[model samples]
Target: MCACPAQKLCTCSASSLKKTSNHRKQKRLFRKAFFFLQRLTRGNQTDTFRGLLLKSTCSFMKNSIFSLILLFSAALTGFAQDTIVLNNGDVLSGEILEQTASHVYFKSAAFGSISINPRDIAEIRFTQDQLGEITVPKDAIAKNEAKPPNLPASKKPEKAAAKPPQKDTSKKTKKKKQWSGQAGLAIALRNKTTSNLSGVYKDEKYETYRLYGNLNWKGERNSLRWDWTYRYSEDEYKIRDDFFNITQKYNRSFKNKNLYATAKTLYQRDYNRRIENEYLQTAELGIKWFGKDSRVKLSTSAGGGYHIYDRLDSSRSNKTSVSLPKFIFDENFSWKILSAQELEIIQKYTHLGNLDDYHLVFSFGVQNKLVRELFLRVEYKIDKDTEVFYDDKGYYDKALLTSLVYKF
Candidate 1:
């Protein structure tokens, strides 16, 4: 069969069309030959016409059969995205180098690993996990329960095959490969009539709240985290404030795993009545412990830094209390009630010499599929002293919010 270069284009990819085109061209040739045979028999005797038609039919069928074999061969060659299964129930998508009764050799496109035994494997499969330019199919998780080859059906007996060598399962038991990541984005709004931060509270119920997002990138061993939070309220003036933070984190679940810690820095910009600019710098070292239970997880960070408060320039009291950074402790926890919902709590303690106060952050949220590619989040947050606002009197703030999020 003659091949066409441009025929490679398809509704999905260019590869499949080339194979289909070759099959279709053979079909067209078969149809043409059959029609020609019928035309030749139009002016012939009964015997001659029957023989001619029979001969043409056989020839076309032969060509069709050959075409099918070619099509199947082309479909299987040089285009296989095989999945490799591990003993600990882990799977990797890649190309297969060898498939035998005992083991399978594979080479990963993203992460590299070597020979794998199918005995400890649950299954193996091939799929279209790879799609567009640098994008893989989200639903490309395929599984095959194909069992090992059985003994021949022949009555004659043959020599048994030798088994392959085993690897160090002890070391494998000590370490496990993990797939971990977290990412989220949110926006919120609030309104207060007319409120005062300090010195006799008034009615200022106009405020807007927005939390940009946090992106977590997981590497082979470590992870990088970037996150920010922002809230803005408008009374007679345009007031906007934001809090930004970045962290480089490490996590491990195995006993022999390395230390899990994080180094983070945060900045805040607030425009309120009493204090305008509040800035803080912190460096913390902490450890995290989690399991597949997902019911409970805890993380604690303790360190020291400097926080500036309004230059301590209060003219009201000559005995003003300055906001000096002494020590800080942060505690965070997450409880997964269900597969789609979670309960989280955050607490931060600020020890500023004499004026020490703690702010509590707690929320109850459920991650549910609102619609196609859409998610709904409803959370209620209350602070014992929500007065984190500029010049907020020693009081906490409370609010409830709902959000609709879109994802790609």
Candidate 2:
């Protein structure tokens, strides 16, 4: 098994021998590269090159190889791509989607569609693939500039021939309608205990929940919308109150004018107020200030409507139906305080045939964006009625509520 001399033995296995062979091959390749570089420099710099190559470690070779690979990749990327060189020495290589005097639309793999201002760009370069030709060297271009190439008669540039007018091929498109709406819920819960001088103990649990929503559709000249609110509350003993109201409105703006016409209808039911059913229909001529998309908006209208309702007797034993003509005044204001926040206030007053029989309702609300199509809403509302059939003191209610809202 021993092929070497007396005390010396070969410790090489098959793997070790393969590794040794690889090391020798690498040394030969390194020597060839060193000699090539030495010949290429071939001057006083030859000694510097030789010293650096011979004294460098394997890691240095690896880093140099990696840098060369990166440079080659960059060169290949620049060959068939469009480029934009920014004034701050930033470079982008991608396909140019469009170019205009003011802006350039470019698409890149790293970034999606991008809009770049022309002023921010220092230069632009496009590929010659579109023309199916390659560029020549600077020396050849300079020679051509010095002496124009001779051309035959047909090859010379000629004045463009006048062409007939082209027919219009584009079709007219209708304006698209925009739709938006929101839905929300507000709820409250409470627990209470009461004791009398007679030691009569009473405990009650109260809870209230309200659900509301609105839907709106807007077109070029016409818009339609509807709103609904439902509230129900109860104590341990029995249901305290149940209320519901819904209104639908249709509006049309006059062409080339700020005036608009509105038609609205409302239906309501309230168990606490002894309102069996109520219906109102109103037509109004209104005026709107500012554009529809403006940050601030104000609108007001005055109208007359027919109101019909049935009310229960004071004993809650009999129902009486009555219809009357009423007057109405409505005003609305909205402000966009921030890109993601909005505030709105609305006031409405109704007057029956008797001056003493009237009601006023005021509502204020704010919506803050939480995420896409979702919001946090805070609302304050007041309802005051000067006349009542079952109670001596007029009805008055106020509430401060918060809810989570979703828009679509």
Candidate 3:
């Protein structure tokens, strides 16, 4: 166990330091006294024993200083004592448990049951339980602080005078931040309805299977989002790591009555490392909002983007003739039909400068949250394109999806 720097030191630990310090003090005093005697009688005590004792004393001091320096350095860079001070002075020293808005729980003591809170609490404390007289705040004290049972009622101030107005701390509300994330697998099967949309190619089936993982850190005034996705083709090996992407999104709620939007950007120095290619950068901006939070369309954002895909993997590759710039947009929505299910939709468009090819995609999905932290999803999607796609681009034979989803 380490000393808790937050509170006072323990007596045993302090005693150890005191003992080592006294030893050093005795050594220093002895050396000082010897030096004083030498100064008092100049040129006296030039004996071998006296010289040996001085050398030994000096060597021991040098070694002690070095040892102390090493010990301090080792502990300094190591994990130092940490503490989390809560507003109400209740200290929690380990990971906390959380379920939803209705209740929250935390481990306030070791091998102790978690305390559930119906009322919103201030922040949670995270620290090691160091040994000392922990300072429990006034709020955690007994309710009758001003009254002493032994006091005479007549001697005490008249009831009203004894009760000084308590400070109005009603506005002091503290809410600890919560962590949230989603883990779901998206299973999509695409079919083509119109062959002319793909032009040269007929209805072909392609699968776009994606697993999305996100972690959201909730905070006052703002929140941070980390998203990572892994997508692949179920039938054909069409795209490589090109199907993967990562993004950081910042979210906030403003006072605006009916406006909300999510703007994002992406950057990658190398699309393919084994085979060098031009740097890739994407910039998207859009805003789509709702009339109200309960309006089914939890949130909607419409943003335009500029994308640049430089050199292709091979110099002779015709996919990207030169550095390209294009437009991009996305829209997302959610509708709750049942406590166990939600309906979702998304639409996006992309254009490239090289061949003037345009792409548009629309998708509808249903998600069922069957258990705590588990979900199932199904979706249908369509793609409209002017240029011919080799194997992966065009929509499935009918531009629709039929598949089973299992999420963890």
Candidate number with greatest TM-score:
2
Query: Could you give the candidate ranking by lDDT, starting with the highest?
Result: 2, 1, 3
**Tens-digit per-residue lDDT, 1-408, candidate 2:** 555664343444656888999999999999999999988877768688777777786668889999999999888665778887886789998877665445457777787567666556767777743433323323222111222222221122232367998977686767464988989998644233322223234444455689999999998889999999998876444546778999999999898557888888999997655677889898888898878688887887777889899977555569999798888777887777775444443333443334678867776878777877787877776666665432245555666777888988
Q: Mind giving the per-residue lDDT tens digits that candidate 1 earns over 257-323?
A: 3235555555444333233345566666666666545567666666776765442222323322335
Model 1's alpha-carbon lDDT is: 0.52
Worst 10 residues of 2 by lDDT: 139-148
Q: Assess the local accuracy of residue 32 in candidate 2 as a C-alpha lDDT between 0 and 100.
A: 100
Q: By lDDT, who's the top model here?
A: 2
Give the TM-score (vs. native) of candidate 3.
Answer: 0.41
Q: Model 1: residues >4 Å from true position, as ranges?
A: 1-199, 236-259, 272-277, 292-295, 309-323, 340-355, 383-392, 406-408
Worst 10 residues of 3 by lDDT: 151-160
RMSD of 2: 26.8
State TM-scores per candidate: 0.43, 0.51, 0.41
lDDT of 3 by residue, 1-408 (tens): 556774455656887998999999999999999999889877664676798999999999999999999999767534342222343555445434332233333433353334333232444333443334443433333232232223221131122235777888887778564787777666655544222322333444555566667788876546677877665543332334234567776666555634534545554332222113333343443344545546365444444445554433222254553444555545567766654344344333334223456545566666666555565566656545434343445332323443334333
RMSD, candidate 1, Å: 35.2
- Global local distance difference test of model 3: 0.49
